[model samples]
Target chain A: MEQKKLITYTAGHASVRKQLLLFWTFFIIGSFTIGGGYAMILMMKRYLVEQYHWLKDEEFYDMLAISQVTPGPIAVNMATFVGYTQGGVLGSVLATLGVSIPAVAVIIVIAVFFPGFKDNVWIQRFFAGVIVGVVAQIATIVLDMGKRQKWTTISVIVCAGSLGVLFFVQQVSPIWLILGGGLVGLAVEALKPKSAGGASS
Target chain B: MSFLALFGVFFKIGIFTFGGGQAMIPLLQKDLVVNLAWVSMKEFLDFVAISEITPGPVAINMATFVGYKLRGLTGALVTSLGVILPSFIIILIVATVAHTFRTNLWVSAFLDGLQPVVLALLTYAVYSIAMGGIPAWWGYVAALGILLLILKYGKRLNLFLVLLAAGGLGLLMFR
Candidate 1:
């Protein structure tokens, strides 16, 4: 009876250990993914694209485009994709947790100190500066996506026209632009088969 | 609803938000705003705006804000966790299965083809997002200049500062 009980306990411990090991390995893998639209993307840019070389320049650019185009936060999706590609289910969990860990911790701290710095002039000033950085960061990703995608002439025209329409016609929904642009893209491909490889067909 | 129920809603958000958080918009509008009547459209709009302007994941922000609105801090916690749970679960399952097919050429080719379409979508998204906030020609100029700066340098400028300034300026001038 004693031996059986010991064996059961040891088995439970071993299984738990295996699960945790899997989780941690993925977490390490997750740490490498550079998320789209994330503050960490900026902070880790050098390490990822520059130092680590986990994502090639072109691949990084493509990843940026995919993440942004998809309906979710570009960062999370990008992270998940990388994690999944590299480590599978365990990898994804690790990546998601690794990326989220920082944000979650920060939020918890902020919440704990609810309105902690609301009236502090200096904190406000610092945060305002962070906003400029964030905007610059956003601009960086957008440009990176454009350069990486290597827009065709039709795409350029579509972009310019859409820019105008969106700017001038505030009432027009952005969704319309996305749908119309896609349809126009199909039309352009159909018309200019030689130029763009005509992928639509 | 209880905190657990709120978590369940977020879990649903995470699971079916297929494309990502923006995809969650209509679902969120339908379920949270319409069916549940958890909050008003105006408030929902406010949440959307906050999501865009915040630093982390937009969906996470929306979940946090909405949760807070419905059930205070605890509600916020449950909803935020819930919204991300599906992605975690799905990705885990998908990742495990992905190993067998990662090297398949057809899949690779399909992904390659999807790249350009994704780029098209992103280009469209950027134009849509940037064009709205500023009206004056100078405002456009600032945006363009910002774009150029980002391309030339990097994300060195602080984000929070810019928003407060923009909001303050907007309040001062427009309001």
Candidate 2:
């Protein structure tokens, strides 16, 4: 009877081991990802939900939604929020720090050295190519978003109008476009009939 | 720049930016490149490329790189802290009340409106960055080829490898 009780306790309540696992998991994810924030979503879902079963699919997605709605980088938000859920404040800190290690170390190295060699012709050529790759990646993201959107008249107008405004008025900050969109959305929602019952598609 | 001013700028950027790291690009370009002349547009593109190549959040990477450029190691630390603090504090609050927050009508409505605008801004970023980054005719061809490969292969093709390959190609082409 005592042996059975011991086995169960060891299996279920190894807090330190769980914390280490959490830290390591985030560290691995952080290390591998190239694009920041939005790019990490798939890996997060795969590791956190499918592999470890730390969160349900719905739960992972909910966190994603919340991350998007809130400020700061989505990657940081996910690390902090998911860490909190799994291991409290300590877990959050460890996970955040784990994820941050690569960015800090790598950027510091480049910051120290890259500027000194900025004028090198070969290095400049390599970066010029890399920027092409970056542009292609952004193009992919734009394509993906375009496919996902449900283009209504209002949404089309809003999108095209903002693009045109930005094109013409180079000095107009994007802050205004985002804020204006929100206010317009709020006003539309308020004007809707009570019987409408749900958000407009 | 002084540490306090650096921290202050990043902190404001951290709080003001919504959507994610990509969304912060326009603001960063406006503030850092256009207004302050801290880094030129060419250098800013370099930063973006570096951020994409490195691990962790792009926002954090940008903070560190820009900070280090301006003020060395301490600047990097301060800017990172500035960008991170808002998300950390905000998430703690939201995590406790996620259900309520998700169900809030006003929030959903606001996001719905913001969505289209965010798309426009992202598109603008692509345009602006591409204009400056891709000067040669072959560069555009390279970009198009890469875009096709990514679209066709999807996630099966790793981006890091693709970038490294492009660098190799750049060496040969530009030579």
Candidate 3:
């Protein structure tokens, strides 16, 4: 008949200090990560998985997979996933806020100080150089993903087919390609022998 | 544009666009620059460059930059919230369901299907950026150099250092 105390029930959970630490970790990673979400993946792995041991390597990959399949930036998705898994919804909110703060501050400053920033030759040259690095970063991601696949004949065909569609077609949306690839995968999966089908990776 | 309109447009951009930051460019161009005229073409280009060089997702950075341009700080906050809100909600839902469906056949198949398509998208990202960014011979050389450096060093090398080295190379060669 008596109401249980909420504080006592939640006592074993992470303290606010630990939550704040989670926030700061994401904030620092967000502040330092340049290029884009793909680049952020590598950083997240290094800091969250490798350095801190907050997440297991398999769990991190699973989150990365979910981040890709779902909509939104990988960085944001990752932050939300990590936070939720670690500290629940509050963790999610805090992590997202932390990751966003640095970008907001930097952009605001740039907007104020550099109204005519685009015309600056030095900035242009700097980006022209950074663009190369960004491309390489994406390339590295592609290689990393490619290496992860089990590489069956069906997968090889799917990879080539998707690449051809993307390369040759002018106006096909990636969303459609993604959906089609899913169908192809479903069909391939359905047709495989039961014994072989047991090995889903 | 009104605050509501700004939020609406960015929210739409957030949900509909896939393949991450670079993939949002044409959509942003069409909706914000061409249709609404909230941002100019030149400003959009500059925003793209700034977003790339800055420390967050391009989509979020663009949202903040444009939001500030339109309505100062409130605009920045509102637009960023708009852009990230969809992903946040979607990911929250997916994360919730993912554990329950971790071993489902259809789910695994769908994810497996996504693997190649994701690869294609990444490859396309590399191709598109290279087409636009690497116009000269030196640009190609620089790209090749960075790729080799990453391959050799793997994760041992810090990306920031690689970027800084590329910037230095750009200053010397591009100039």
Candidate 4:
């Protein structure tokens, strides 16, 4: 009976062990990551795409795009998607927990013991410096994505136009910008010839 | 605040926040720090800084930190759950349907459209953070150095190590 059950469950795709490995992988990545979700994307690319070959480059970029458009943290959204792809609902839960546990553990310790930690002068200076680094990291992602997209005319126009509105308009929600971009994409696709429209430039 | 109130507030934060973790700051400040007086503005700023430096989503870290401040481990559990619950449910639903519709032209086009906008949003993030003003010359130097280093050797070097090095340099120069 046990052998039969095992065979039934193991017909194809991820097994329990693979799910556990996925959990641990995210746990370690979540623990060490600094900066923010964008930073985590870099780490994910290194491990998931380059090291393990779990996801191809295009797949990773697609995931990144989906996570961005979704609500909540990009990292959490990504964890959910990746986990679901690998091992369904249970995998999603475990992966989310794995990524979150380290943060909760570390923060709880700091809150309990070093309540006044931020008041330290040296820590403040260090954060100031780190902020600069964070900015640089984000800039790198922007440039990297630009290169990957090959900076088509429409893409460049959309990028610059969005930036201009955000910079000049003040208080315009990014959601509108996102929606407008979608509309523009659809409109462009509708207008273009059948063959050209199908390809994402 | 009651645990239910805590959960409710965080759940609202989770669903509404878009463009990722940093974008949630204003909403958090408005609701928790400014209006509710749960934390002071200075404390909120400190939390933001701490959230960024730590190893997690800024929103999640903020929820956990604030919850711990308000009510210890239980509060942390509740608030974090509150924040995560919405996203978990939403993503689960989307994931279930998304795989089925992966080849749908409309869906693909929507995602494609979102790409450039997401890129723009990321660029804006860089701009806003830099606008915080570089107080010292070292800050600029550090920022440029990090940019160059990452551009050159990012694939080989661990980001955490670079961050640590930046912290050390900050201590030496800024402190």
Top-TM-score structure, candidate number:
4
Top-down lDDT ranking = 4, 3, 2, 1
Among all windows of 10 consecutive residues in model 4 chain B, the one with the lowest summed lDDT is B100-109
lDDT by residue for model 4 (B8-34), tens? 999999999877877788999999987
Per-residue error for B139 in candidate 2, Å, reads 2.1
Per prediction, fnat is 0.12, 0.69, 0.63, 0.66
Model 4: CAPRI class: medium
lDDT of 2 by residue, A1-201 (tens): 111111000012228877788788888767766556654655576578767887775456446655766788888888888887877777777778777777788889877766554456776677667667767776776676677665877778888999999899887666688778778778877986766334422
lDDT tens per residue, model 1, B26-103? 788898989999889987876665455434566776787777768877887788778766665554454345443214
- Model 3: DockQ vs. true structure: 0.51
Q: Find the 10 residues in a row with the least total lDDT in model 3 chain A.
A: A3-12
Between prediction 2 and prediction 4, the one with superior TM-score is 4
**How far out, in Å, is residue A19 in model 1?**
16
**Candidate 3 - CAPRI tier?**
medium
Q: Say which candidate scores most in lDDT.
A: 4
Name model 2 segments beyond 4 Å from true: A1-95, A111-115, A196-201, B1-13, B16-75
Ranking by TM-score: 4, 3, 2, 1
lDDT of candidate 1 over A30-141, digit per residue (tens): 3322122444444334444665454466555444434543444555666665555544455556566665544443444544465333444454433333343344445565
TM-score of chain A, every prediction, order shown:
0.64, 0.59, 0.78, 0.82
Interface RMSD of each: 10.9, 8.0, 6.3, 6.0
Q: What is the C-alpha lDDT profile of model 3 across B106-136, one tens digit per residue? A: 7667667767777777788788877877646
- Selected candidate, larger DockQ, 1 vs 2: 2
Off by over 4 Å in 1: A1-47, A58-72, A83-91, A101-139, A150-201, B100-102, B154-175
Reference contacts reproduced by model 4: 0.66
DockQ of each: 0.16, 0.45, 0.51, 0.54
Off by over 4 Å in 3: A1-18, A55-58, A195-201
TM-score of chain B of 1: 0.79
